[model samples]
Every structure is written in structure tokens, then in C-alpha cells.
Target chain A: MSAALPPFPKPQEALDAPELLQVGSGAEVDEPCLRADAARNRARLLDAAGRLAAEHGAAALTMEGVAAAASVGKGTVFRRFGDRTGLLAALLDHSERKFQAAILSGPPPLGPGAPPVERLRAFGCALLRRSIDELDLLLAGEPSAERRHTFPPRRFLRSHVALLLREAVPDADTELLSHTLMAYLDAALLHHLTEQCGLPPERVRAGWLDLVARVTRTDPPA
Target chain B: MSAALPPFPKPQEALDAPELLQVGSGAEVDEPCLRADAARNRARLLDAAGRLAAEHGAAALTMEGVAAAASVGKGTVFRRFGDRTGLLAALLDHSERKFQAAILSGPPPLGPGAPPVERLRAFGCALLRRSIDELDLLLAGEPSAERRHTFPPRRFLRSHVALLLREAVPDADTELLSHTLMAYLDAALLHHLTEQCGLPPERVRAGWLDLVARVTRTDPPA
Candidate 1:
């Protein structure tokens, strides 16, 4: 049965993007249109809300809490983000942009300097940490099954993993492998492992490293 | 960072079930209470419904279509399965039982008497084919992300994979690896890969074999 299947494509050709990858974090695509100080104020509110969510939980993140945390009027927050749902979406978008920046251009390992395998390791670890911090918010924003793969942030992240896999294991099916790797870092899976199954985050992180090693056929970093 | 993490438990300990694995296919647990004739009649209705779904797709499946197909009254179909939702769920349940039987005791490679690695490969291939045939129905019945990992049918399936991985790779974290393997065979991922991405089912099947070989550190069968 396997012998009858078509030959696998070269990793580079198979994983090549036909169009430019959509790197824009959703909701932040409109950032430049805001007046400079308005953008700053929005950033400030999101930052305050992010801290509150991180310190307490996403359920604790209210428009009023964000207003008080940022020392802006509650009306300012309402005007900026409409309501609690809008505020949560903006908070997620804010964190996603920061995460993307770290991977796209921050320091080594997670950024550009490290080797592909090492970068892959750092990427999952960072994502695991970020997901743990924002599991509730991430779960709340999960796209429907139909849209799950097509969602822009998810596509961008998966594309990043695919790109790294192409560099790390150029002879393999990195396109599919990337999805498998990304599945390990999925927010819902993280929630189940941590909150439901009661596995420690460190154990899950170690599993990620082990998975990256196995998938790429590389030795774990010493 | 990895050293600070606690050691992974032996595969046996980690994968051990505290309770007997719930082998019951949901909706079928109530089977014994019905009179034998009523049960036979229900099976006949489900069989008709399943054939209609397979031939014309799940959306084309209706109470009237099932009744006509089975040469029974529409009221009988309605009474047996309640409505279209009930009918669809029963159709899926019927297929799940057949699939479980195949894996549990039906034949070699897929059933018994095959090497663990071979069984794992055949298990995925069988699932991929089943998923393709029932893609529409599976996507429609997808559990919410919170419940996805906990859904009884899903847990039963995942436990099977985890058990196989334990045999195939005793030193690895088979519990975590099982989730990684199961994610590949996920209905949503299958839908996205085949329908949305236009990959043929054979390509997806080949990918599954490749994944099994990589995760188990074995060569694909010659």
C-alpha cells in the first residue's frame, strides 16, 4: 500500500508559501490608523489589563479593572474597547503581537541568531509558558473547528514552525511535522494537561523538547 | 532547564489507567434494556441510516430517506432515533463500535497478533479512511475544546493509542506522545488537510505512516 503512494516532495518545495505569509496579528492590523497618543493609550490599557490577567486571571480582567489599573477613566476603557469581550480580545492581540515580535526579531534562540533546532526548542518553550499564563484567554478565543487551522494567528505561528522545520530537517515532511509539533503547544491541550490532568508545566515543557528532538532527529542541547 | 524538570515516569506507570478504560461506545450503553426485537429493529434503522450516509453523505441523510431506504415507516425511523440529530449521533456511534471491534479483535495489524509498531501504523490508516468517509459527520459532532480531550469516545481512542505507544516505545513519555499521534488523526485536521488544502487521502495516509515511523524510531515497512 505504501509503495503505491506518490513520492514525497522535497522539504523546501513542499513547504514553500505561494503568497507572503500573513504575519499581521489580527486586531493590531488597524494600529497605525489610530492617532499616535491614542495608540499609546490603547497600549497602556492593554498592558495594565494583561498584568491584571497574569496576576489574577483572565476572568478577573474587567474593563473597570483595566481602567483603574491604567489610571484612566472607566469611560476611557469602555470607549477604547467597547466591553469585556472586546477588552479580552484586545488583551490577547496585544500579547500575540509581543510574542510575534520576540520570535521575529528579539534576541537569540527565540529570535534569529540560534540554529533552527535550537530555535524550535525555544519557540515551544516560550509558547508553553505564554499559553500557561494566558490559558483562559486563549481558550476563550479559540476558533471554531472549521476556522481553527485557517485562523490568521494560528497560521502565522504554524508557518513559523514549518519554516524552522524545513531548515532543521530538510529531507523530511516538515509541513506535516510542524503541525504535529504545534499540536504539542496547543492552548487547549495545555489546559487539559495542566488543569485537568494535573501534569506540571515543566513536564509538558520537557515533553516539547523531547518531541522536537524526536521529530527533527536531533540530540537535545547539552 | 531540562535537568531541573523531574524525570519522566516509566511508560507503564505513566500510562496505567486508574480505572478500567471506558470501552463503552456512548449511546450503546443503554442497549441491554430494550427488548431483543426492539434492539434488532433499532439496529436495522441505524444500518439503513449508515448506508444512506455513506452513499449520499450525512447531510443527505434524513428520517424520510432512512425510512424509505429501510422499507420502514418514517414514524418508525423517527421513533427509533428521535430526529436527525439523534439519527446522526447513532450513525456515528454504530461506526465507532464497528471500528472498536476491528481494533479490539477483528483482524491482524489492525486487531491483534501484529507487532505494536505495525498495529499502530494500521490503526492510523484505518482511522484515516473512516474519517474521510465520515468527515462531514465527524466535523459536525466535534466536541468543544474544553471537552475535546475528555470526550468519552475520544478518551477511549486515545487510551488505545497510548497503550500501543507504550508497547512500541517503552522508554518514552507515551502518554504525551499518544496525544501527539492522535492529533494527527483528528477529524478537524483531516478536514482541513483534505477538503481545505486539497491533499488526497493517500497523501494523508502516507503522512501518517511517516509520523508513526518517526515517533517510534522505526523504519516504515518494506
Candidate 2:
């Protein structure tokens, strides 16, 4: 599958360029201006909160829980995030940044060192995993219908898929196709399939690969 | 394209059956118990409201406009539907029933008596057209993310698509693929593509046909 496709037109430079990889919506907490130590403290707090969310669900996440989990004072957690809503937003923003970094520079398949098809497959799987892990947080943060597609994080991710699809299926309607591809990985749909319908994660993962192969007109990796 | 595929297996009976075509969510205005003339009056009022919504966006739809358009007293409109919210719900219910009737027994292609793949193509085009016409109403009525896939009207439409996909590509994951196909016709997505991105309706329609073709692995009709 890898050799059958042309190399992704210009994987590294095109993907690595900061302009192409900006996922921040500007509404998230400004990180660049935070002093180094404060930024470290925030990151550590978010890490603890992320673990709490993954283990106990986002609805169960609390500042006090994160504080105790991170061995920080409750006041410290409060001083950092302000309220539960702020904590939730910061947690999502933190995860989004980490996921964006992984796509831009982390490693092969998911990052930029593999065939576009492989990367596309890897991307969906990784996103599905993340969605499953933070379903509550994602659902709670879902934008209104009018704003859902226009949301910056969504636009950024959709653009990334469009870029990959352009490389894999040059003749396709990549913009529309990217939306279809992203729809398959939608948080709402994932919740319905996994939580409501009881579809196993493996089945959903397999469906993603199958869908990518069908859209790209390639055989699924055996 | 129609002749290339097998005839839709038991199209008329399968699709015509009331059980297979039920679209009501039980929350919409109940119509069965209304007196005959009263039902006709309600339908007439809804017809006027539908036109009002389609011509001047759903936001502009009002009891006064509908009463004037239907040549009925304002109190009649208010009495039939309790308020603007009730009017909106009834308008949507009226359209849903009409659309359901079309798929159940109305005509070839969209109804039955056509190959499954052709029906699938026709289904998407018809849906996109309807969605374009009632974009606001649909978006306003969009269920929350948690309830989205489980909503009865949505579930019925998805089941319809899944049934078509079953006949068209028996080996594929029709459940997941049906969701993908329906996602293309989502009101929010349509709003984004046409209203936000400024794509023409014909292009969005073309994308639907292309998506159906790709998903079914069939050649698009010339």
C-alpha cells in the first residue's frame, strides 16, 4: 500500500510549516505569555486532570480531584483554572494542542514520515482513541450547529484531512470528501456507536480503515 | 446504471409497509385524532407556514405571516399551534411526514421500483434538495449531540439509508456507511458548505452523487 502511492507531495515542509499546523482557536488560554514555571505548573495540572478524565470521565473531573492527584493545593488549582468550566476548557485545549503537536512532529504514520494513506488511517484511529477517552468533554464542548463546522479546531483538523486526501486521491473532491471522512470520526457519532449501540472499538476502528480504503480506492491493509 | 444492478429486492412491499416508514418521534403534534375538517385546516395552515419558512428563512416565519398567507384569522393559527415554537414543530412534523410518504410509496427512484444503488443516489439528491430548502428549520430542530443519532426522525431516515445500502452493498458495513452518507446531507454541514463556504447547490449535489458512487463502488451515471 505504501509503495503503490506517490510520496505525499512534500510531506515534511508542507506539514511542518507553522501556518499549516495552527490548531489554536485564539479563544483558548494564552500559553505563550505564561512564564516558564507557571506554564510547567499548568501543564502538570492538566496532565493530572487528563488522567482523571480518562479514568473517571470528564463529568467526574474536579479541581480538588486534580489538585490531590497532582499533589498541589486546592487553592493552586482554583487559582489556575478559575472554575469547572475553565478547567474543562483548559483540559480540552491542552489535549488539542498535544494532539496537534503529535500530528505535526511526533512520529511516523501519525506525524509525517509515512504514506498519506497510512497516515490517514493512523490519524482516524488515534482520534477515535482520543474521542473514546474524552467523550464527555468533547460532547460538552460541542459547538452550536451553526458554529460546529466553523469552529477552529474542527476546521484545522478538516484541513489536515483534506491535505492528505489531496495527496492520496488527486482526482477526488477532496474538500467534500474530507468532511465525509471527518464525519466518520465525529465525537457525537462515536458516542452513539460505542455507548448507545455497543459497537466494539475494534469494529469501529476497522470501519475507519475500510472507509478510508473505499474513499481512496485502495485495498485495506491485510 | 439502473439496469446494471439487481432489482431492489421487494422494494414496493418492503418500503411501502407502514412499519418500515414510520418517522414520527411521538413528540410532534398528533394528527390522527383530529376531526376531518380540522385536519384539513391544520394542513392548510402548515402549508402556508412551510412556504413562509422556505421563502423567507425560518427565522422570519410567524403566526401573522402564516395566518395571512392561509387567509385565516390570526387566532386560528395560534389555536392550531400553541405558539411560534409549536408552529415550528408542526411545520417540521408536516414536512417530515410528507417526506416519509414520498419514500414509502410516492414514485420511482426515491420511493421504490428502482435499483438500490439508484435509489441511494436519488435519496441523497432528494435529501440535499430538501435540506437546502429547509436548512434553518432543520438546524433549529437538530437534536443535541447525545440525542442526535437516537432521535426518532433521524433514526428512521438513517434506517432507510441503511436498508438501501444493505441491498446496494451487502458486504459493506452498511450501518456505519449509512451514517456517513447521511452526514453528507446533515443540515449543519449543508449550511457550512453552501451558506458558509459559498459552494453552489449543484456542486453540493454533485458531491453527494460522487460520495454514493464511491461508497457503493459503482460508476456514476453519465
Candidate 3:
């Protein structure tokens, strides 16, 4: 899962899995490995992206600057990510994966092995915390129509939440309820809290936990 | 009390009332004093909006076409509402007032004086029914932000819901839980169910009621 490929795969595979790596012990491997120069160029492109994101914000990143930083042709950068939108999505995916790992296995409360209700509360807080920390990354990963409509991460999060709620609350409508909870923590909600309401990220997380604890408990406080 | 004017002597006075609206004589004065021609134009605009929404979908409502259909200048349309975005918001507000009336005073289950749990279920169904019926209006009115934040209708609905939950499920964290319910009925979720999941709107409503009933009731079915 953590290997790099020598060349970009076919367009179909590229569309399906943006993160592709080629690794094997086959003599018939006609593709040359990533040259040291090519690897350096890739690293430079990524670094330039991070710097731009940090300084000017994600909305400021440009393909032209990325090409200049990587010392590559504009065509090369385009060929790699298709467009600025694609590059931004790929960058967002990196942070999203790390976030997924943290909730799935990294720590208590948010990770596995907590009381179901507490875990649900922790997951909401963790997600809210991440939204605050990676506002730039999230902004860059502009949710296109397709990503918002049909995506694995969105579905996975809902299913995970549904499972947790089913165990903790044991109501028949866990699936839809879980979906609602996921929507509550979605980009639109976060944007409203952070931008419109001018609420601090920590306060949002506190509200999330409060909601979660109340919803999941056997008998919520009056 | 049922007059068009506010309960207070003036609209500004109503702003300071304990409850949001006191439903007083001021409502009569606040009524739109549209000329016959202007009233005709307003109807045309709303009718065009509905037709365009029905045929081309919500994403298709543009300023130019709406203005042309209403036989008004683009500037007039902009003056009526600030922009295309504002026009959409106004359209939604129109529909929302009708919905608010229905839930607050129109009928059983949804109207006042029903069992709290039943009322809660009815409210969710009413909201879902309204969403499917007016999806374009809702989607168009969505504030252009990166995260989901509470809109006025959403907040009103949450407050109504919190009040009911406090009565029926008094032991639960009703305030946050109400938010969770509102989040589920968000435009995004409805689109997912109707467009992506291929579920009929009626089924979604039934599922919503079933889920709410299960959680609201104390004794579990064998």
C-alpha cells in the first residue's frame, strides 16, 4: 500500500484508484523504475503545494507555480494530475487517509475499544477537530458533484456510524440516523459554524460531543 | 391574533417579544402592498421558478431566464432580491412560511396538541415531504459555504423539535438530538435518497417515521 510506481497506469485505473504503485519481482517488468531525478521532481511538486497551501491558502495554488517549482513542463504537471482540481483532490486524500487511520486505530475514544456512545461522541469531536486543523486541505479538496454524490469515504463513514449507533442506541432507524449524524458533521455544517456563526473549532467539538452523548445514552438527561 | 401585522404595534417591537412572533395587528401593515401589475409580476416569477425547477431542475434557475419569463428587466429582478442567490433564498422562504403554518397550526400529528412522539415523527415526515416537493428551492437556498451551518428554517425546525423531544423523550439530550434530526433531512441527504439511492420519497418518509417511533417509545417490540 505504501509503494510508488514507475509510471502512471492506464487512464481507467487512474480514474478508479488515484493512489497506484507498481511493485513486483517479475523479470518481464518492461517499465523502468522512477529515476532519482523524477522522484526529486515529484517531491518538489508536493513541497511547493504544501507551502502554497500554508501561505496563500488552497485557493491560491496554481499549476504554473507547481510546474516551476518542480522544474517540469506545464504539460508534465497537467499529465500527472489532469488539472489543478485533480491535484487538490489528491492532496486532500492524503490528509483524509490520515484522519481515517486515527479514528479507526490510533487512539482511545475516537479509535476502537471505547464504550459505543463515548466512541461516537469522540468520533464526532475528532472529525470536528480535524476540520479545524486542516481547513486549508479541506478547502482545496473542493467536493465536486461526483465526489459529493458517490464516494467511498462518505459511505464508509455513514456505515461506521450506523454500526456504532446500533450497538449503543439499538434503534431500528440507526442507518438513517447515522447518515444524519454524518451530514451534521459535513462540510456545509462545519462551514456554517466556523464562518457564519464565528464559533471556535473547540466549541464546535464540544457541541458535537454533547449531542452525541445525549443521543447515545440509554437515558439522556432532561 | 391572526392578523397580518405583528402582535406588537410595529415589526421592530415584535423583535423583542419573548417568543419570536406574537401574531398581532402589525402583521396587517407588514403585508405586501403590491400593485395589481406588481402582484402579477411576482406570481409570474414564482410560477416560472417552479416550472423551471420542474423541467430543468433547481440548478437551472438563472437570473436572465427568470427575468425574461417574468417579462421584467434583469435589474428589476435583482432589485426584487439582491441576486440570483437571493432570489432563490426568497423562493425558499415563501415555501418555508407555508410549511411553518402547516406544522404549527394546520393539522393533527404535525399541528399542535398531538402526542409528542407522534408529532415528532409527523414533523420529520412533513419536512421530508416538503423537501422532495421543493428540492430545487431548498438546494438553491443553501448558503454557499464549505461546511453545513444552520439556516433559519433549520434552526426553527430544530427548536420545534427540541421542544417536542423535551416532552416525549425528556431524559435524552433533546437540543443536540434535534440538530441530528435536522441534519438527516438536509438537502444533501434527500438528494442521496431520491437521486442516488433510488428510494421513493414516500418510502423515505415512512422509514423516517419508523425510526423516530422506535427511539421515542420506551418499550421495545418483541
| Per-model DockQ | 0.50, 0.32, 0.17
User: Cα lDDT of all candidates, in order?
Assistant: 0.82, 0.82, 0.62
List the candidate 3 regions with Cα displacement exceeding 4 Å: A1-57, A60-86, A102-122, A144-147, A163-171, A198-203, A210-222, B1-31, B36-41, B44-90, B114-118, B146-151, B162-175, B210-222
lDDT tens readout by residue for model 1, B1-222: 562336665543454452233533355667879999989888888888878888888878889999998888899987777788888888888888788888888889899899999999999999999999998888878878888888767777888888899899998888889999999999888888888777778888878888888898887777
Higher-scoring candidate on TM-score, 2 or 3: 2
Lowest-sum lDDT 10-residue window in model 2 chain B? B1-10
lDDT of 1 at A51: 90
RMSD of each: 2.8, 6.8, 11.8
TM-score of the first chain of model 1: 0.89
True interface contacts reproduced by each model, as a fraction?
A: 0.43, 0.44, 0.26
Give the alpha carbon lDDT tens digit for every residue of A38-98 in model 3.
6566556766776677677777788898787667888987866678876676555555666
- For model 3, residues B1-222, the per-residue Cα lDDT tens digits are 011211212332222222332221131232379777766776678677767776787788888888887777888777666677666665676566677788778888888888887788778877887788777666655544543343445566767887787788775545445666777677866877677666666556755664465446433212
Please, what is the TM-score per model?
Answer: 0.92, 0.89, 0.65
Better of 1 and 3 by DockQ: 1
Say which candidate scores most in DockQ.
1
Error of 1 at B43 (Å): 1.7
Least accurate stretch of 10 residues (summed lDDT) in model 3 chain B? Answer: B1-10
